[model samples]
Target: MMLTKEEERALSGEYGEALSQAMRILVKVGEVLGAERLVPISHAHASGVSYATIGEPGVHWLESLVKGGAKVSVYSTVNPIGFDPYSDIIKVDENFVKGQIRILEAFEKMGFDTSLTCTPYYLREPKPFERLAWGESSAVIYANTVLGAFTNREGGPVAVAAAIAGKIYEAGLQVLENRRTDSRIRLGFRPTDAAEWSAVGYAIGERIGQGIPRLEVPPPPRDHLKYMLAASAASGGLAMMVIEGVTPPKTYLLGEEEKVEIGREDVEHMFGSVEDADLVFHGCPHASLKELVELDNLIKEKVEKEVWVAVAPRLYERANDVIKSLSKKGVKFVRGTCLVVSPIDKMGIRKVATTSAKTYFYLKRRGLDVWLVRLRDVASA
Candidate 1:
């Protein structure tokens, strides 16, 4: 593995033994991945720190970085499992809270902002085409694919180390060559619809854990693109994909008339049947302004209804005035909790109905009561 000047210097005992050990691990990782250089990332968001059931490695490593006097830019955002101030969506056990605070306190000390949710894209405001290094599996995929942001599926400590060193090991998605699509899976859907696209992503990702795909779908609605990215990131572990005739090479490389056809049944086989949920959830990746607007529109017509909903802090700020008006009518706007990370039974929420394929899978892994509901149905009810 190639090492940076700073990394070499650390090996020579420049940044102290502890720092050297950390950088040594990074060097080994870079070597294994065949990365040639190091590139500084503008932002970061890490996941797997918020443990509802057991240990949180995210918290452990972050505290170490902070105690070691790690440095990071202020714009960096974090995704973790935590409490929701507004809604009773998640319950943080005492031990989990201690771990969370220790990790976050470290971040705070190191000049990082704790966006503190899985959906950092919705909480931390960044324009399209911005580059960030995120560690959370789904968040990395969501930020890079759906939002058009740049990120590689990096690990938790590497994210902190990237922040501390003001750079990341050039590997996977970081290199332009690595970004090329090695394999392709075609879709018969629309990149325009967030929900359908999300469903397709869920279906495909469940089947192909690490395959880079090219999607061929029908023309879709505006919000559907969000879910397409969300579901794929949620299920497939996909960090990025090129929409056939829409994304870069697929759209640009093919001259006037060149498209491949994939069967619809192929799409169905990607996601297995999931049922038995009690509450409906959206915004697993982070609710965008468009989705929030749709939610506002849906709530206006809701009469005898109560669904556990969570949104991003960044989106919450953008739709503040409107959400304030909606709150008077009865909509629980939660800031820092997700259905997957929350203690459902403690909140007295035994069953959950959701449109998110990612949420459905994660919840089902816990052996909880989760029902799959269409987004449109949740929109009305």
Candidate 2:
């Protein structure tokens, strides 16, 4: 792979050991992926922040980068951590809290925004054709498909490296020619809400298995589209998709695609009954402010069940009025964390009811019986 003089110097250790290591990692990754050269990126979002997911080794790696003088060269953000530091409702081991705090400090020392969200696009909306080095499967696919940005599904360390170097290996979705899709899906039914859209996305992912597809359905609301993209990425590792009027023209191509029809029945099986759920949760990708307001409106009376909603800290702060109103109605708003990465099992939450397929997928893998419900039903579940 070819490198500019500055890149070469950085790789050779003239730019400090931390930057040299970061450059080496990017160069090695690019070479392995057949990237011809490194390209500049506008932004980066690193995942793997949850202490429950990465444990001590991840913490050590981040601390090592901080010790080596690593600092971000571009605007960068981070994914959700293990749990909300301010929430007293959710309980976990003291050791876990300490580990989470160490990880947070490392990110802060390295100049990352520490947004603590899977949906960094909500924090900083990328323009069309903007290049990003982002982790978190859902965010990668959303940036590529919905926002018309260029980014592959980056790993946690790779994204952090890209932030430090301000460059990424130009391969995968970064190259326009590779964005062409030869698979098409026709949706016979319009999804009513986020949960149904999530089910449709899960079904599409199950069928396509990482293959990008052109959707024939009308563009749903942005909030619903968010859940669909998140579910597809979670289930199928999908990085991009083309929706006729939604995805920006010239950013994607449709070939002689094999057509498949998807209807209501196809996604019916994806929704599970919410009868015995110990906890009702929402916001796997973290709820947007609009969604929070909608949740507030949907619950007409105080909820009888334990209801938890996850949201980005920034959004949570902005929705103070909505949060207080919902709080009176028995809604607990958890900032900067979600059920997927938090130690809910340790908190005695066995069966979960959520409106997100991505949450359903991860929690079920952790031995909890997860149920998929509609957005309106979540408040009452």
Candidate 3:
């Protein structure tokens, strides 16, 4: 493999042992995936270092890294840490406040510009033509497809590795060949809304697994496109997949034109039912403020037994006032937690409902009755 002087320098322990070690791994990831070279990223986000998400081990590691006084070579924002309104669950009880504060202090000391939001693309936009290696799966899809930025769904460790190395692959999504549509699946329904894209993305994900698909569907059904991709990724273990028509693949159609059949039954099998749903989850891939504002209205009309909605940190604070007004109703607005990863069953929650096909499958896997319903119906019910 060839190396730029900076790459060779970074590999030679010029950036410290941890960063050097991180670069080696990123190089390996690049090699395995056949990436040509590491591209510079203007802005990036790292996931899985959340104190709340990974529990004790994660928290301890952050503390240690902070104390070690490591340096991050590039500018990056990050997912949430500790308790915030965006997350429904916060790991305050697990860690000593002193330790938690120390970790934050260390990040500050190390000059890591951290913003406690998972969906950093919402916070700070990554422009088209800029290449980034981001961790959070939904964020990667949003950047790749919606914003036309280039990124792969690099995992948490890899994001750290890339950040340390100050580079990630300039190839993959950056290249024309890899970005071309590999297969095609015409949708049965035309999604007139972007929210429904999550379902369509999920349905196609079920059919094609992790491969790219030229999805011919309208962008309707609701709000938030990443929800569908997240649902698909969660069910199928696909970190990142492409929607050819919607993403940056407009001119191309499945590379020489090939047709693939997706059985309605196959897409339907990934979901259960939403008939008597007891819970509604908004943040599979983290809901935007638009979804939260919509949920606020849904709260008034819902008037159900118990409905909890999670939003991003910034959005959660805004919804807090609205939540107070709906005290009489069975609606609760929370954040920093999601139904797919949180403990809903312990809350005496059986029978769940979601517009997200992703959450429906996860809930069903946990032995709960899950209904895959539309968001409009979910708000009314």
Highest lDDT model number = 2
Model 3 lDDT-worst window of ten: 85-94
lDDT of 2 by residue, 1-381 (tens): 999999999999997888999999999999999999999999999999999889999999999999999999999999998888877666778999999999999999999999999999998899899999999999998999889999999999999999999999999889998999979999989899999999898888878887789998788888998999999998887999999878988888777798888889988876765567788888978898889889989999998888899989898888889989999999888888888888889888898888999998888788988878898887665
TM-score of candidate 1 versus the correct structure, residues matched by position:
0.82
- Model 1 bad stretches (over 4 Å): 11-13, 16-21, 53-60, 85-89, 119-131, 146-150, 182-186, 189-193, 218-222, 244-277
RMSD of every candidate to native, in Å, equals 4.2, 1.1, 3.8
lDDT of 3 by residue, 1-381 (tens): 567888878777786666666668777878887876777777667777444356566556655655544567788766655444333333344344444455556556556665656677776777766778787766776676666777778777677667656688655665655666666776665554333556666666666676555556554332456776666666554544445345654422246446776545545544444456666555666677676556667554445545555556565556566656554455565555466555557668787777677776677788988766555655665
Which residue runs does candidate 2 get wrong by more than 4 Å? none
What's the TM for model 3?
0.81
In terms of TM-score, the best-performing candidate is 2
Screening candidate 2 with a backbone cut-off below 3 angstroms (N, C-alpha, C), the clashing residue pairs are none
Shift of residue 307 alpha carbon in model 3, Å: 1.4
Q: How much lDDT does each candidate structure score?
A: 0.61, 0.90, 0.62
Give me the overall lDDT of model 3. Answer: 0.62
Q: Could you give candidate 1's per-residue lDDT for residues 154-226 as a string of tens digits?
A: 8766766666556667777665555555456665543333444566667777676665665555435535655
List TM-scores for all candidates, in order. Answer: 0.82, 0.98, 0.81
lDDT of 3 at 282: 52
Least lDDT summed over 10 consecutive residues: which range in candidate 1? 249-258
